[model samples]
Target: ATTATGGTVPLTDALELAQQGLPWLMVFDHAGVPLHLGRTKRLATPAQRLALIAALRGCSRPGCDAPASLCAVHHVRDWNTHGDTDIENLTLACDRCHAMVHDGPGGWKTVTLDQDSQFPGRTGWIAPPHIDPTATPRVNHRHHTSELLATTLARIHEQRNQEREQRQRWLSSHTRHTHAA
Candidate 1:
């Protein structure tokens, strides 16, 4: 088996080395704490780890659909500011969401989903408003006459359908060849 550092050794070789009964030393972190070869405790308790996993099961950012495996663990409270390693201060977010959280100019607007308040009101995943609404009534597009626009949209939709059919046929032929092989 290969160790995390990329060094490989045979299992029999390792067992023989262990059987020799040489004095072994195990170190934890940069601390001088020592332990026997087979003795080690996890950094986080089982409950704490499970809580982290639960938080990651859904995207931490509002309205995101990315799953746990595609997300990263984030600290609600800054870790450098002496935040505890408890589950309450941890969250999981996708890379895009995480970047948005730390962005400045077009940054994310974070809010707790607690019972007290609801963020984003009706639209859960929209950019923040920057301009005031105009006092004048909005123009209705249906009243406008634009035959060219309708024809263009229809042609685009037809082309998309044809491309989809071609992709499906390619996939079917590839599957048949794989089964024959």
Candidate 2:
């Protein structure tokens, strides 16, 4: 690996330096090239990285609190699996979380949630079957407390509205039957 100044450094050493809050290091791709290109189909551009940083405050995996600066641009669908480098298919994941994602039985799987999801257009991490029998997808709200609160409040409100509607229908039917009798 090479730092932004063109000094060659081992990958593990670079990671350690970054964790120590080194402000000058720039992450490079597997080819040891800096990922600053504005238009690249493989690596994310600077603008794309900024967009992801804006959208996700930290790693998208559950129980992780790594900040966006320490996170890498990850492909929700594996790049080797014919997934494109589109912004919609990308997410932020810390190095540890990124390594945990795979197709193996014990690995975590990530998916892009739809509009109907609690966190639309976000990455949802699905646990292995042994961890969750139903394989339910979960989002990391650790970085966004307001979103969690909003989702909880919306669910509660929807449930109450449904119950109220059901009760009104029952009362209307009962009144109609009484009048007919």
Compute each candidate's TM-score over C-alphas: 0.37, 0.64
- Against the unseen true structure, what C-alpha lDDT does each candidate score? 0.47, 0.76
Q: Against the true structure, whose lDDT is highest?
A: 2
Of the candidates shown, which would achieve the greatest TM-score relative to the real structure?
A: 2
lDDT of 2: 0.76
Q: Write the per-residue lDDT of candidate 2 for residues 1-181, one digit (tens) a residue.
A: 4332223578898678767875334443432234543333544466667556656757889889888878999999899998878888998999999998988769999999898986678899998888887988898887667677777899999999999999999999999999999
The true-structure Cα RMSD of candidate 2 reads: 11.4
Per-residue lDDT of 43 in model 1: 45
In model 1, which residue pairs have backbone atoms overlapping below 3 Å? none
Give the Cα-based TM-score of candidate 2 against the true structure. 0.64
lDDT of 1 by residue, 104-124 (tens): 555454332343332111112
Q: Provide the RMSD of all predictions against the true structure, rounded to 1 decimal.
A: 19.3, 11.4
Which residue pairs collide, candidate 2? none
